[model samples]
Structure formats: C-alpha cells, structure tokens
Target: MLEEEYQKRRVLPRHLRKQTEPERPFSYEIRPATLEDIPDIREIYNYYVRNSVVTFDEKAWSHKRWREKFEHLQKLGLPFLVAVAPTGQVLGYALVSPWASKSAYRYTVENSVYLGQAATGKGLGRALLEALIEASEQIGLRQLVAVISDKGAEASIALHEKLGFEEVGRMGKVGYKFDRWLGTIYLQKQLNPRKKPGILKRMLGAGASEE
Candidate 1:
C-alpha cells in the first residue's frame, strides 16, 4: 500500500486532511529524508523546546546530534517524516522509536511530533503524526508510545486519544526544563499484533504494501 501510494505520489488518507492550506496553499511531500534538513529541523524543534512544553528537553540539539538520532531511529526500523511547504520549507517532523532497549520491547515503539511555530494550529502536527503511524504500520510495528509534556499539552494529549491511543502512565515531576517541573504523559497505541518487521523489511522495495 505504501509503495503503491508512493508510486502514485499520494500517502495521505482523506480524513486526515483537516488543515491543508487553501487552494492547496500548503502542498507537501512526504519522502525519505536526506541529511540536509537537519539544521532546519533543529531550528524548528528548538523553538518549541525553548518556548513550550511540547518537549521536556531544554537544551537545543545540534544538527549533527539530530542526524545521529535519526540514524538510530532508522536503525530501529522507524522512518522519520517531515512535512514541507510547497516551497520546500520544513513545517515539522515525526518519528517512531523503540520504547526500550531490551529485545522484548522491540515490538513497542514511541512516537513524537514537532512542528514549527508558523505551522502550529494548521494541522501540520496531525499530518506528521498520522504519517508516522502509517509508516509504522507499514513496517509492521505493533505498538506506539507518546511521551507528552505537561505544562499541560492537552491538545496534543487529546489528539492522541482521538486517534485511538490510550493513556498508559503519567510520571509527575519527572521532567525539569524551562525552570520548573513538567509531567510526562505516556500514551500507547497498538499498531498490530501479528507480524513484526525489521528495518530492512521496511525499505522502499520491502514489505510496506505494494497495494
């Protein structure tokens, strides 16, 4: 399905089209990534980290470090996605990662969404997250986790719930950034329960669905 869609150049489902800009004012392409976007990604993500509780880390991540993290996620069989404007400006990114280092946790992954300020409230985060779920399922992942920040990110939290994720746990005062404490909200979604694929199995010509 993913390959067939990619070949046709369409990956989005209709219901997910909540905030596409007018007249396709916000046309975007979701493709495999390159190293070039890391700087822009860092700039966009650090903005939220510095200003909001969307993330708990206070320190700005360097592009190199971001690139390395991408490597790890890819190795974990997760694809990193970016939503870009028609002009190629990156609006946001989403990805899935292993929930734990143990082999037993391999079927369980975590999800994250980070968007630019200008992209907020425009449904870019939703798009990014939805894309990640599709990619995660295409790769045969079984579970997804969302670790949310708590200066109270109700909308972010609510979006996950609306998407079929259930709150599994919350840790109070486990995160300290921006001068105070932030709670960690853990949510999970089961992708599938039967088969699981490794990174190599999710490559372009891999098992992602040629339908």
Candidate 2:
C-alpha cells in the first residue's frame, strides 16, 4: 500500500530515500533496545499501568515477565527500540510484536509505543513510531496495527494518523479503568501489500513437486 502511494507521488531515487528519513529530536537518541534497558522500560510502562488507561493491566509487570517479553521479541527478530537521553535515562520505547499466534498471520504485527510521563508532548512518540515502521518493513512485515485506547490520548491517535494509520475498528466500552469504562480503537498501516504468486513462482518456491 505504501509502495502504491509512493508511486503515485514522483518516485524517489534509492539514494534519496535515506535522506527522507524522519529527523529525530536532538536531545535524545533512538536505538534498538538492550536487555539492560528493560528496567527503565518497565518503570515507564508500570507508571501508566498504575495511573492511566493507556494499559489495561491492573498489576505492574514483574521483572521476570519483562525479561521474557523482551526475549520473545528478540527471538522473533522483531524490532524493540528505546529513546534515551544523554544522561542515559530511557525516555520511551516502541516495539512490534506478532499480531496473532497463527502461522498465516505471521506477516502482520501490532505495535506499541509508550513514553515516560515526563516525556509526553516532546514529539518523541512520533519519532519512535517512525523507527518501528521502517524496521518492520526491513524485516518484510506487510501490516502494522495500533490498538490505542480511546480515553484522553488524542496525541497518540494523532501521531498514528500522521504516520498513515487509519481507524479500522473500535470496541465500545470494552475496557474498565480508573472507575470508568474505556474503549479501544484499532488503527492499521499497510507496510507492503502482499502479492499473489504465479503458479511457476509458487512451484519454484515450494521446490516444485510432481503433479
């Protein structure tokens, strides 16, 4: 889908494509996450879990669980990235995980980006999401989905829209948080449209069996 849209605009030369990469804010750096970053990531996420509707979890994640989650993404070769300040503090993180457990759903992934409470409104969320989208495409993912909460997070919703995600569906009052019912909004961005392979191509790909 992105490819189709790109073609509609004038095509950019290969070298020029890199120049079009989104510029990151100067004070912090975005990079692939390390195991050592897990503690900070968890602290940031736990703050939301305890104080906001951004996460549905009632309890904070345990250290063991956090380590396992990071390892799971690493084993799958999906991108898990963090934004860090020069002070070596983790400001935020973004990651892509398998959308579903089924084999046929392998090419599609769901994304999540969370910021430290203090880091909101800094354009860091946009920067983190853009990095995730690029990494997903490089790893040959075809679709990226964001399951955002429809509470007070217009900033998150707007960021998703700015990055090409469209509202695909919404579940009304499906979540209960902070003494009120909350809803979920699903937004999706098609990274690369999957093409149907011709019979010859399929045969070659499958090691051509006798008919």
Residues 72-125, candidate 1, lDDT per residue (tens digit)?
666555778888777888878887766765455666678878777777887777
**lDDT, model 1:** 0.75
Q: What is candidate 1's CA lDDT for residue 93?
A: 84
The TM-score of candidate 2 is 0.78
State how far residue 71 of model 2 sits from its true place (Å): 0.5
RMSD of 1: 15.9
lDDT of 2: 0.83
Q: What does the lDDT read for residue 51 in candidate 2?
A: 89
